[model samples]
Target: MDYQVNYINPEIKLSNYTGKLFKTEAAFTDHLLVWLISGETKIIQADESFVFGPGSTFLIPRNQLATIINIPKDGLPHKAVAMHLSAERLRAFYNQESIKQKNTVSKIFSFHKHPLLESCLASLIPYFEMQENFPENIASLKITEAITILSAIDKDIGSILANFDEPYKIDLISFMEKNFMFNMSLEKFGYLTGRSLTTFKRDFHKAFSITPQRWLTKKRLELAYYQLTEKNKKPVEVYYETGFENLSHFSFAFKKQFGFSPTTLQKIKTNS
Candidate 1:
């Protein structure tokens, strides 16, 4: 499908002035993140009801049904920022697998308070609605800051972005893509981003929703799977080249994710 990458990561859409009682359900094509500022708003996800006050945020996963309830109409009411992000884009942006990134997902949905965040969200509202003259470009940078501020306010999310901020995160992801075949360590990753191990782990989870180890393992295994099946590489070659220390571990993880062992999948490919 043709898609816009502008809203993929740290993208923001802001609107000032009051909100009215939402009379209809709103659905998104991707993950929806809403930060409520000032007044009170109610969000309903399935049977659950979330009451967001002045510093509360809510997340709605892609294709999920959600409703905005109790939108206040009194006076200027509340100003808010909403973001729509794709799972694939987020995974690619962080250079990690989407499945292992639970902490990152949690942070995206979690809500908290930050004066700087509020101000940033507030400032972006105008730009978000502009829809002209590099609006997406400006909004993309602003959204990156918004995500960082969100990470700072929440410890869980902090784990994901620990190694990333501003220009460095973008650069680091590019570096990883180029060096995925190399022997990368926590120390090297830390040095690349100027973060300590502990800090990196924390932010990694917070931003990406997956531990670095888990992400790396999955990446390696995924590459191995593609090579064994598509490239017709031998299992031993795939295992060693993918950086797995042990063949058994690689097979186990591969089966766990793909629902079948690599040997089984390869045989099926050959038979077909």
Candidate 2:
């Protein structure tokens, strides 16, 4: 069977396919709501892991490192409807609320009883099935509708959607430590830390005594090492989670870092 995964544009996306595991070394750029239609979808991040099936909805926060596993049920194609939440569309609805109030962030993943979601999806899926290039306004409204349902259920969610404060540099070290798992360009890392590309390089050297590239590589390799040697995880399982895009790169880096290939851990586990 040929392997394929589709992600067409316009925010409202439909994916129907089958695969063992799809790896993404980078983080999610936008917040997303996904409802599995005909398969078991499993997502694992460094901090959390979840599995969802038919009619199950998952809300994934932006900038979280995750690997998705897709398995079809009953020999059918895996199907899902996903809505990507862009900052622009969210800001429109956010402006109506009190943006000054402080609220803790919503979790990266959450499960809820949202009947509205089912109804909206029922209406939205037909557009995808018909291969219609629907207007952006229509899709944008769907995004707002999802958020509205969320805010009705949880006020904190409303606050998160409303709060779009620009990233700043006051807490550079802390921010990097928290977000380094995201496989983004150094420029993006700089931007998220509220610094220009050049300024980020200079400040990064001052704080860490190394270039951003070297630091990120070392940090990611360290994470892989801990998970492999200490937690006994497989290289394929943790490669994407630790910010490596592919297993070959992960294996090479692992051997360079700790003087042994990642598979050594698995071999040790099997023998002992």
TM-score of each: 0.42, 0.83
Give residue 216's error in model 2 in angstroms.
2.0
Candidate 2, which segments miss by more than 4 Å at Cα?
1-9, 25-29, 41-46, 63-77, 97-100
Give the lDDT of residue 182 in candidate 1. Answer: 36
Error of 2 at 191 (Å): 2.0
* 179 Cα displacement, candidate 1 (Å): 44
Q: What RMSD does each model have against the real structure? A: 17.4, 3.0
Worst 10 residues of 2 by lDDT: 1-10
Using TM-score as the measure, which candidate wins? Answer: 2
Model 1 residue 226 distance off true place after TM-score fit, in angstroms: 54
Among these predicted structures, which one has the highest lDDT? 2
Model 1 spans > 4 angstroms off: 1-11, 16-20, 96-108, 126-132, 152-272
lDDT of every predicted structure (CA atoms): 0.58, 0.73
lDDT of 2 at 160: 63
Write model 2 residue lDDT over 1-272, tens digit each, in one string: 43453443568777777665444443556778787778777776556677787888778766554666677877776787888887887878877777556657546556543687777765776676455557767777777888887777665676566656666676778877866766778887777677999999999899999888889899988888788778877888778777787889989988898788889867876688
